[model samples]
Target chain A: MILIRVHKECKRFISKCLKHNINLITIKSDKDDLIVKIHDNDLEEIVRLNYYSQIEIIKYYGIKGVLLNLRKYFFDYIMLLIFLIALYFISNIIIKIDINHENTALKERVNGLLIEKGIEVFTYRKDITDLNEISNAIVEENKDFLDWMSINRVGMKYVVSFEERIINDISEESGNCHIVAKKDGVITKIVADHGVTLVEKGDYVREGDIIISGEITLNEEVKDTTCASGEVLGETWYKVNITVPFAYQDKKYSDKSRYNFYLNGNYFYKKNYDHYDEEVIFKLDIFGNNFKIVKQKEYELSDLQYTKEEARKIALEESSKRLLEKIGQNSTVLEQKVLKETVNNSTIEMEIFIVVEENIGTTRMFEVGEEIDTE
Target chain B: MLDIIKSYISNEKFYIIIMDSAIYIKNYSKIINIADDEIIIEISGTLYKIKGSSFSLTKSINRELEIKGYVESVDKL
Candidate 1:
């Protein structure tokens, strides 16, 4: 909008404009001038002619309105472009999934199980709504595998929890079962709940001895065939022999911090997959998740590896741990034999045989097809 | 030639005058520089650096005085 006035009260300019039949969308008049708001294209020639400079053309518009006119081009074009670019960077671009399970096999099984329910792997993008349905499907189909389940959506990630099904072998309904000695040993003690015991305290029994019987009889009549169930701590013996190479080389670089990101089931990393080296390997399972590191990282590797005397010592310690696991808890070591000993090229090798005393028992239950009536 | 040269030098204080055999300054010799007892004028660049007392003399030559300082160092910067 521009304000214009003529020096003389003549209508020379106005008359010419009227004769030319110019179209102005908005026009107003004040004490001595005409205020015309016209589009930029049409007002070019009018301003060029200088028809109003001879007279005083005062602007009465406020500063706010003047600034608004100046910002029309800047805000409508430049600022809008800048705002859209900022929005693109702040938006979420990746989707993450959190799997909660103690067993990798079961977790993978559940993932495969979810695929059966139409949940594709990194292909079809799904949100919490699909997550909820997948959870429901897992709960319905894997009743025997999972104890409980839950699905959650945290930001752009989908988390699923599959609680493990803990099956306790001992219960009141397991009366149709029998406990047998898993190793040849002398029974040190016995605790029974049902069925007849075939061995007594200080009684020597071999492997497969029925410590508690599942059959029952009274007055020459068939009464009950229940599981013989009880804990019978027996004095079991074992001989274990282990050998280690004297000259062995173990991997010194165990700082394997595998940072993995998956996009469409693809992996990227810098670890050399082709190099063969000396290393000791072991696996540690926390809850149901497996982490590979240090001495545990070298175990079960698809590459050739060896360990020196120091790592061999650690490997011996790990082997002792495995032996303890097989023997159950803390057991007494009766005798040890060093079958062979050798040393080579910064390596110490020895073959040692050991004897251990332990308690081994296994409970077997026979399920009855008929129900017992309690009167 | 002298009559013609004297007629052309009448209205100017400094003019080119051609005499019988040599050229001469009409009222004074061609002043290559303007100097005074307290100042010196050096025309080393496109313009003259009027130092000390010669500033007033150089100032008098306003329309003809050109300050030839480096344009890129000041104006363009």
Candidate 2:
């Protein structure tokens, strides 16, 4: 049917050409554009006489006159060709990767793992497949941390969502154990369940000291043993030693910089310079081919001297940061003070004291025939 | 029924079909008159005159033609 239509259109175009006294033969009609073979002699006459009907020779059998006619739209045709090629390359790549998770740490870990497996942003979609298999493999690899995981593709982006495994403390409930002090602290509160309270409130306890005993005595005789589970809130003190340097190095960048581009793992312009920082200005990756525009700026490091007051402030902040690292989460900072400060050569040294209210008890299991040590 | 049998027997000759606002003609000998509002076609020894508004010979080949427009009348002369 299409061939018949084309043949009919060709005949009609030829007949129209004859009626206009234009010596032309119809080659084909491409939708709206009618491609015709016209004699060189009649071309000028056709152009002058057929002002109402637009005609152009698309191709010539033996003459180069067609190139002159196409010269008007040569640049437009070239741009259209380039645009089509760019579109084809862009459509095959994954433009974005979105991990659906609330925890930033877990998202970063998953993103890193996906990148290792060759499924990342700007990667070709055709290169990654078997999403279910990959998801199962990832879950298996992180079996201790992840319970469920799934990867889905939406347009050019891969959406990853996962569930982390929550480990439950079942040993405390199952074994006969005593709650001992994890660290040396003064007991502020104590709650003992299914055991005897060894330490009362306001009592000072040492590390490894049992705050709650698992033994239950009846008629002043040992009768039963159970898991002693409770919260022993204590006032813990931490002493952190910190040193802050009086002189610190600051980076000073030069105003001069050079620009370069990299395409497909090869640099368009290459230069080697030490102590230079590269800032990426633009980046594009299509079908595994990467393009990057970068600015290289050179810099030097110089020491800047700080005053005594500034050094003390810096030392205090450093000490506080160190103290926080030692203290576990869910602990309340009750009070903090700089116990001692001394100025050394080119450095400020200080000792910090911090008091925190925290859970200072840990469960320890005992064998059936084991004797209890009271030390 | 007689016309159907006759058409089937003379199927190799010229065939003309008049549809809504379109005319399909096959085995046409020549185009007598071509214009924007009317067209005259010859098939064998007879001339078929097609009158319409804004008429156009949209498709034409050897011994075939497709006329498209707001067809007003078709007569055999």
Candidate 3:
């Protein structure tokens, strides 16, 4: 709505002129001010009369004026139109490809394979159907490594998942072998099948000694040869050495923290600390614009003193942890004892002896035409 | 052809549009009287009296004017 500012007596003058039929045109009043619509000739005549009222143009509007302005700034409108088109085109393409696998090499291989099949980052989603065919082809090409594969599209990103094939050992299938001791130990128990037991309980055995023989004899003549399979349990000992320090430096954090933000490599607040832990709150990258928020927590390091009991407990725990790591996963711990412990001014040293019952027999394949050298 | 041109140029027929709470007039000639509750407008050679509460003139251009308020009645005078 447009409004014209005029003198206070403008309404009275216009109304008097209208009554005289002086072609005064449209005239309306608010208290003392008047709104008048007159032709150019009539307005000129009014001004010539030198009336006490004044007039001023306040606002104007028409379709022709709007179209003229749009024509004048045509390039800006064109740029806006192009920007919208580009946004629509970019949103439909894949921005990232995430392969869910623990092995980096396998993930890279799968990604390379997908790219070779015309599927990768920045590829249009509409152009990349037939994912099942692609996955089948990949699995077929990598049958020895990939057991199953699948691809899924999620919000401009392609998520790929696959499982690796696990190959079993083939030596167990061929039973033409003998059981030999893998480590020197005392035999605690033995159970033999399809072979002759060469070691008995409480018998001292050495590494590379045959525990079970695969040869079978009948009437003092060679009958047949089969793989010797048995479980020979033996008691193995290990000595674990560990040292614990009485004084150490530990990190202590303050209750206060500060937040910082960055946009396109420019920091919002510039404050640096010597000892602080930074945690990323959020990071965003859209159309090459980067933004990040980080929280920094300040901390200090202080010396901590340990008592005799604390040092001894730490030493024992460390020794036991070291011994457990040395023992294999399938072995059972039979007994454990701390053989010796020595305490110094600032350190404590200890030796732990561990005895475990484990399978000591390993298969040794023999050639069929080889002479039996049982010396 | 000259007569047609003269007729087209001299065409001064008035048009009045009464919408909800607003009145628009084209080819308006004058304003006869204006009050807080009523307003009288001259268009072509006839007078139109608009009665309402809190009447206001919102806009004015060449031969055109717009009135806005609670319009109760419109009568030709």
Candidate 4:
């Protein structure tokens, strides 16, 4: 068998071989090559007699060029193996949605409602339309909610929004609760809308005095009774005390580093990779109109040096912040003093005492049986 | 087997032995650069060179040198 790349015209070569008394048993022609088979005895004579001019017959038939082809190689089939593996991995990675809400009972109710409408917590990734459908379903279900609120996840964080419900006012027929001044002070002002006020601006009201009355009397006969629900702005005096530490032995994370990954709210990390330089990643959560996102910053955490003055200042500021959150915002500091200081090995502990005057008066019903239920 | 070049140290000279081929150098000599196209060495206050497309030599910073064409062997004259 002979294989050669030629421009065409294999039949002319076979016909010429037959004319030379050579048995051209087989002939095959392709786009760029031709193959012919003959007896080796005829091939030897054809070369000796220089009768290989069958190529001239090909040339006469417009065959352009001819060349021999030697095919010998192995097969590994490696590229086809990699293509199948890539297709297997890509088909499994998908997105999943998880809802984390505070009210477990309400969440179960909502989950059941959504599942009835073909939206379940464990539903497949392809079934979700949008999260708004779930939120709208909740609002449609709870019509009596006075302060209905919802928090949803936008991408990776939760966004909370709420609507305040106003409670309807009851008519004033039976005797309602009357709010009175609890301290001895001069009434700066009074707002009496549903009830009758017995005192006005600049009126000196003693402790347990009735600034507004719940009963409306005419000609010494009971006409109606209403709730004395109004503010009595008074010049009230108070005394507050706070304590602080002058120094502290703080335990902080060293320059040791640990890399962690979290999935489904669980943290996972390798136990071996520990030694790192001075950088620590700090993440702070910030709220936006759509969702909440974490802002991460890399901080170089240095070893804490002993500083008594800085510790004292930090303690005082911390105590003041805690006090203000409990008291009203209008409260002003009247006095402050470092009452005590105790220095230990690595910590110089101190206490800061403070006093302030703030408004701290709120009213509750004093009835024996009527109590408002809260959930 | 003829392509394999093995190196060893003699009493006072370094010897390279291959199939039907041998080379010798003084004890103070060492192979400084060997490339696919050439082999260079410093021997006893003299320089010896051999040129051929023989083997691969890697330079610092990960560069390869390949010798091509005819091989010409030389010794210190």
Candidate 5:
């Protein structure tokens, strides 16, 4: 606004301004002319009203008279708006999930269950009541595998605690049954409680051969038939073939790394090195925009050559591990020997034989349509 | 009959209210004249003149304005 003094014919000028749809605000009659306050918007055309004039602007008003002052800080305000939006969404994101279980398969099962319940990392955090509802539903769905489960949120992490179901064993009574050899092995020990012991320690037995007969005999004659029960520990053999490369590539990380930012799906940097690893450090969502910070570390590839002796050692370890996976974990490894070895230009292959002490007894009934060759 | 006139005129009615020290006028056509003691405006094809003392516009837009002063009388001219 500007306060102006119109020298002559002020009413005619005001009427002319109103005729042209321009408003004259705050008018006051002076001794000779009229002093008026007019906005800067109508100043241009009102200046051309008359040349014989005494219209002069005396006073200027506030900073809002020029609208360009607000337009200069437009980018700054937009940046501030984006920052506030990011803070809002980032505070509601789930970052980590910790399952308190020592077993790997059980941990994987619980993790899968959590994902099915919509409680996964990088998703929005659920309310406490909703999380409790989901946990109860999961426990109800998997009643056999899980006995109890609870989910609690601490900061950005969801800690899941659970206990597995404990099953009881009910052994059936052995009646008219004989302990036979399940596999071809040499007997290491035997403990018979009933019937008669047909084989002693260090006795080599084949499959389908009964180690404890279901008959009571004296002086090489059958007196009676009774149910036999016993445990037979035997030395079992396993053959494993392993192949390993003579040259192996190893990746060792260096201390040099670069932190780069990403918006939406486009990264902000070019590939500086030919070989490097990228890891996501942090991420945020601002409205519909995605922001991520990634760390890129450059590494050098080096090939380490292995000798025949070193390859043999590695093959032995691998063969033992494979044999253990095939058998149960309770069996003990007795002995291992290299049966054959083949060496190629860049690889080493070995065939190894492993001996283990394990239970080799399987029960067989006497008169239940089974052919019992006790002769 | 009122609906017939409102349909052509867009249903805009001229309304004015007098307060202690301010006068609010809505839907007036244009300003005919303005002075320290009198303000004349056109509303409904008739001139409405407001006699006041030390009249100054407190707020204004395209079709609305608030005049701050001591209002003495309002007459249809």
Candidate 6:
């Protein structure tokens, strides 16, 4: 841009100047004249027109103007640009790792895993996908010890938090306790460790009857109370009544399956597997939009009918399963018999008697002098 | 063909407007004479005279010129 002074009367010369479509800006300088700013390219032609022989360019603007003013401070501008680039690189480098957990051993273990995955200090920050994968891998590797682990990035630092897994155990449980009969059964055996043996083998004990007492007895006087550490194996009986329909449908799953998803989850297009069960393998919600992946296991159905003998056999097996579920895995199904059976057109009902040998003992804590059974 | 030429001629007709202290001229092809108090410009085939005081003409897009001054008279010759 070019700025020039023009006499007021010659403003008509401005009109003559306009006849050529020259881009210019006019500012009223005083009562007698004005300053006209135009493109530098138009100055040569405007001067050639002979209307104004004295159009002096007072100052430059635009790129040309910037260059004219910045020529003296070029080095400073270059140094500033370099400083900004260095700041960008420094901001992205990981400087410190903060493991925010109470367990120092667990913290060190997690730090080792993180460093193994290139997540230590003074390294470039990993992308979001890599960080998420590393978190999942570490959690899966130590599933028994770690309940959940999360790694989050805050500026140039990595912040980690986790929870340790806790499990329940049965030893000398429920302090100051006695091993009582959990079921009304005949005592088949007794194994005592820390408590006074109350019932002998082959004794008929009722529910809530103590098999081993935590109180120490001395000449009809009580001494000290301790948790009973023993198990009482007994013979128990159960009469279970069951009814099952003779005609039933059985489902068998085939190996053919398909994956399905929408939204942020990975796109997968498999052939549609019809008549199937859908299991969601992965799911995450983002801003109320569901991203999901489903595994479809296709199943085929077959109709089956059981005869009277077959029904009886199945009923006995089911009865054993039901009994074990109640008495736990250490029980043995010693005997079974069907006492009554009633059948209709499509169903069979039966009352089955079953005998099981199981350890019928669970701890029940007691306070001092709570019926310590004097001999 | 004739309609297109006629339409072009009508569209190119010069127009002049006088308001307060300014005169606006459109489709002016040349400035035959100009001074502080008076200016003559050719519009189409006719010559138009603008008599005013302290005339300053500014040309913008669409061949439109704005002249600002004390307007006395405008005539076509």
Q: Using TM-score as the measure, which candidate wins?
A: 2
What tens-digit string does per-residue lDDT give for candidate 6 at A134-237? 98898899888888888888999989888888754343344688899888999998999879998999899888888898888899888787888776899999
Report the lDDT tens digits of candidate 1 across residue range A50-97.
465454434324574477666766667677788887455323322455
Best by DockQ: 5
Number of the predicted model whose lDDT against the real structure is largest: 5
Off by over 4 Å in 3: A1-153, A172-175, A186-204, A210-234, A251-300, A326-342, A357-361, A369-375, B1-77
lDDT of 2 at A280: 84
Whichever of 2 and 5 has more DockQ, that candidate is 5
Off by over 4 Å in 1: A1-21, A28-36, A39-41, A51-144, A147-174, A186-204, A215-225, A233-312, A324-339, A344-349, A354-359, A365-375, B1-77
Worst 10 residues of 3 chain A by lDDT: A16-25
Give a tens-digit lDDT track for model 4, residues B1-77.
42322333224343332222322232424455554466676656677676655432211111112222344566563
Between candidates 1 and 6, name the one with more favorable lDDT.
Answer: 6
| Candidates' C-alpha lDDT | 0.51, 0.75, 0.74, 0.47, 0.81, 0.77
Predict model 3's lDDT versus the native: 0.74
Candidate 5 lDDT, A205-255, residue by residue in tens: 998889988777689776777677778899999888899999988788877
Judged by DockQ cut-offs, the docking class of candidate 6 is incorrect
Clashes of 2: 0
State residue A2's C-alpha deviation in candidate 1, in Å. 12
Model 4 interface root-mean-square deviation: 27.8
In terms of TM-score, which candidate is stronger, 4 or 6? Answer: 6
* Residue A330, model 6: Cα distance from true site in angstroms: 4.8
Model 6 Cα displacement at A98 (Å)? 17
Q: Compose the digit string of candidate 2's lDDT tens values, residues A320-367.
A: 666666676677778878899889888888888878899999988876
- lDDT by residue (B13-77, candidate 2, tens digit) is 77877767867777777778877788788889899888888665555544566666777888899
Docking class of 3: incorrect
DockQ of 3: 0.12
Candidate 4 C-alpha lDDT tens digits along A335-355: 556777676666555566666
